[model samples]
Target: MSLVGSNPTLSATVRWLRVHWGTGSQVKNRTIKWLLGLAWVTAGLYFADKGATYYRQGRTLPPSVINTIPEMPPHRAGDRVLVFAPHPDDEALGCAGVIQQAVQAGAQVWVVYMTSGDGFRLAVERQFRQSHPSPELHIQFGKMRQQEARRAMRLLGLADWRILFLGYPDRGLYPLWSSNWTPSNALRSYYTDTDTNPYRDTLHPGVTYCGQNVLRDVEQVLRRTVPTHVYVTHPADDHPDHAATALFVMSALARLRMQGIGFAQRVVLRHYMVHCGDWPQPQGLHEDEPLTPPPAFFNIGLHWVKLNLTPPQQVRKMNAIKAHTSQMLMMSRFLQSFVRQNELFIEQPVVLPIEASLGVVWEEPDEEDILRNLQAPGDFSAAELRMENGQAVFHINTRSKPRPGFSYSCTVHALLPNGDVTTTLLRTKPGRQSADARVDEDGVTFRLPALPSGSVLVLQAQSRFAGLAVDKTIGHVVRLP
Candidate 1:
């Protein structure tokens, strides 16, 4: 079992068995069978160790984290709350406690579902027991998810009219933000069988499935509701939809601020993490356990807070999450892990106040400390972001130079103040990995649209060698001087 890998004694036994039975001179049928069994055990051990390390490190929060358990804010009589979810069940999983508390305090609350959550193909297939289902069936699945969200929110004491759905394409928000900015080339939702918003219940029913439209819709919601506290997904979430939805929310808030109507520094921006890789360790029903943020985030420049729940509140939260029957059927145990004694949230400022510059600026010693220990020397060395010739230039320095016939890609996203983003996607081998797909490999330089003041740049570089991703890095950089 993979659990054996987490224990040194068990893992050692498995390793010893592998060495004794595998790579031997005898090639008998029984020998082969023993070798196969040993191989499986070895693999299980490897994965178990990985999972163990992840959870162990997460529980050991960094020393620099002050206010590790800050006072949970008491709800005001007329407090307004908004929760933005990339999917339906996420709201209940991450913010059910907050919602219940706010409603109990007579605070107005609104829950916005960004997508129909129709992209969960595995759950749908499992539910239908079909390898392939019709597009109409997929739409029906989306509708089911919507109903599940309604039931979940209702359990949290939210009125049906207070829940809003944007009806965007599930799992395709990042692409819509990256390439499909115009109505003509809007990202089509294969599941819903509509290119633009088709749900009559959506905030903007006819809005096109694009980044700008999503931003506008979010802005409209903010302006209409004027919530005092806005809760959205973390930007570093592993899910593309979760990350992009956060970006969209920030963009909308930025535009509203620019127009002198946005919440700006007045409203509280609380972030909840629903999707991260192997987080909230010991995933199962542990209602008495306390939930903590992953260790990687302690020094990541966000102030985290925990909402301690009463026994009754925890039970209510658990019941609300279970209301999402569509998702619960697929991953009930994983869902129950969130119904712990407390919920974690972070307060992050959305503004990046960088001064406008007319000339090039550079920051040296660009190696990211986080990656230094995680990656090899030749994987990724340094990164630089500079403004030159009216454009934002990004250089990702990699020590492991790309070889001929290999594939390399540089993905860059620039977050601007006006809620608009410019992305540059470059690849050495396009379409095919033939020899002709080679290119100059001195380093990867991406040219993005000129970044205005108050912007931040995020860069990711990866390389594929011999059909394997041998090197990759999420680069870091200092702001323009």
Candidate 2:
């Protein structure tokens, strides 16, 4: 009887051990499988996001009048051409074909690089594989980029002396224009760690990085070069520096004309864009293909000029673009996208005449302007402009209902007939207010005093939604009764 009891106990203990070991092994296997699944999910999400960006970039061009516009004719002999680049490589990227054509026609070509463009953090990182680089390192990178620009222009047949580097801060030009309008209040360079021009061989060494100084240098260049045709960055470009550079050039021209500078009257303005949203589609080398304008700009009322390249001209442009080794090393695809068989430009913005008798005119903001008005990943629609007697109103409409406890605000300004400017700020009510107050459920309206005789109207609109604020500023010239 004792032997039989001992055997039964031993058998039970053995069975318990087997069950425990089997369960532990199975749990271990399941945990490993779960971890593998999670890793795959994370990787899938990452690649999906990258693929979506490239997919958006590959979108096709819509049918539009851009296709019907005539290609730019070849340059006439002795054509004095001036190309203004906000950054080093922009001259090669946007105007390579034109540069080659001008050189072949024996036209005098001058290339002006507004900034060394050393502030592109990603480009710096990619070039040096350094994370958290210091400001001094950025200046070094800027120097390298300047050298690259020189080589690129030389490859395009431009003489060394013809290329001028203004050595302004790469990314600070817009801020300088917006706030630091004087030499005493110059905007400091975030990359160069200095507030004044520091690069060698600049047009004006030691010039402060301010609107006053930038305009002064631009005007000086215009007066000295007396270019018959001038090419600059587009006004609606998404890049702040690019847009500001164009504005500075335009403002300088206006200032010169206002002062009765004779040469300003003869210069023709052409604008090019390099920083638009997914423009110049098929974002790689599409040899023999034509470069077309973005569909969003179809009705913006600007005339586009196209320059078709000869076979050799296209090849030379590609070679010149390739000469931007630092940029090509990182964004080769984007750089090559501009080496197509044609280039494009738009005539400078002309003052849109607002009929005095009509009393009111509604102007819709560009899609880019609407996109910029969003603070987060949200939807926004049109920002409509209305002008009337003694009042200018801005109505910003949103497609998506804003989050709870949200409101809107705007600033209205009048460019008075006598060149004086005035501004008023308006905040929408929380739950609705007076009609004259111009508050509505779908959007907010901001009313300003009537524009002065021969004055212009400007609107700076903002939205407060769930701790996020969206803002955009726009302006237009107005006609007075």
Candidate 3:
């Protein structure tokens, strides 16, 4: 009472509590209980409202976002569309909408899988219930995935004959692209334990698991289909197999172009990204949401296009994705994330030849933060190629200065008119000098044998630290002067 006399507001509060709860130890306990109850109810309502708002926002797509991307060109009756997938389920995840639309438009569509997705150990363990699956078991897993692919394609309105599997190693495409290009150095898959295509129905039965064979098979498919539009994975995809598929496809198209194949000239090339860092946000089935590119790709010089789907088309896509029972057992939510109101693709520009005299420059966006803590030095800032003093010269610039424990390399592919590809590799590491390569403060340069005129040259520059590739440039195709 004496304290309350000094503060009128405290006195009024005390009076109110005493009148309502009765003045005693029981009154204090009652007041505390009531306030605690009120807090619990208020917090429950607040969180419930927040959860509802988040759910709504996650499932809904704004018109502004949809309008920002250009619509994909429609497939017509005469169009021949070819889609290349790195794994079994990727076709359904990335291009089921396109396949359905093409079928509805009477366009001929073909789906080619680079691998049967045999290397996923978790899928193998779940499918066959084996912790240490043998090579034969992996082959069986592959065959099962092949059937799943066929069923999924059937759901997308593709006939069995229209689908082809290359049956290359599932996790070995990058090694083929990087180090194993000849039959002598063919890669052996750790999962399948085979250095050759084991599937009987592959495009080329018993082809060696080498880069040249991959290129040859892709070229064969391109020649046979002569597609007007080609869809493959993006070069910047986080998955090594996905990126290698794009490289093989492009190299084949370039070789075909050099051989006077006109399809390479007019074929429209689009890149679909399946694996990026934490992409396709709100990760489960959200049929009403629009699929968009990852934020890291926003300024990467890519022209993005989207294909809107009907409600029926979305349902069909969901069904196609579900056909991959093995994948569903492992990551159903990740697979279902692609079943949205639309699909996304990077509309690649027509491949153009760079004048050797003027040189060519390739610039890659800085994306070191995308994969945390795996910072390998030498993110490619710019790469230039030109002819100087009877030698082909390569000048590569990196984002940061040359550091210890890092190495830079340039691989040049001379696409001869006679259909032979001669590759030259030049590399330089910290405190090491090579005959053809020179490392500077912020870049590296290489001098190589001059390539003949009328031949095409493709250049790729890479940076490695601790034997791990941290960054690389896209294949830069150039013409000799």
Task: List lDDT for all candidates, in order.
Answer: 0.68, 0.69, 0.81
* Model 1 pairs whose backbones collide: none
A best-first ranking of the candidates according to their TM-score comes to 3, 2, 1
The total of clashing pairs for model 3 equals 0
Per-model TM-score on C-alpha atoms:
0.73, 0.74, 0.82
TM-score for candidate 2: 0.74
Model 2 lDDT per residue over 210-234, tens place:
8777878988898889888889887
Residue 271 error, candidate 3, Å: 1.1
- Each candidate's number of clashing pairs is 0, 3, 0
Q: What is candidate 1's TM-score against the reference?
A: 0.73
135-168 per-residue lDDT for model 1 (tens digits): 6766677888888889888888998999999988
Cα error, residue 339 of model 1, in Å, equals 1.2
Residue 276 lDDT (model 2): 63
Per-residue lDDT of 190-287 in model 3, one digit per residue for the tens? Answer: 77888999999888878899998898899999999999999998877778888888888887888888777887888899989887654677789999
> What C-alpha lDDT does candidate 3 achieve relative to the native structure?
0.81
- Which prediction has the highest lDDT against the true structure? 3
Instruction: Supply candidate 3's per-residue lDDT for 88.
Output: 90
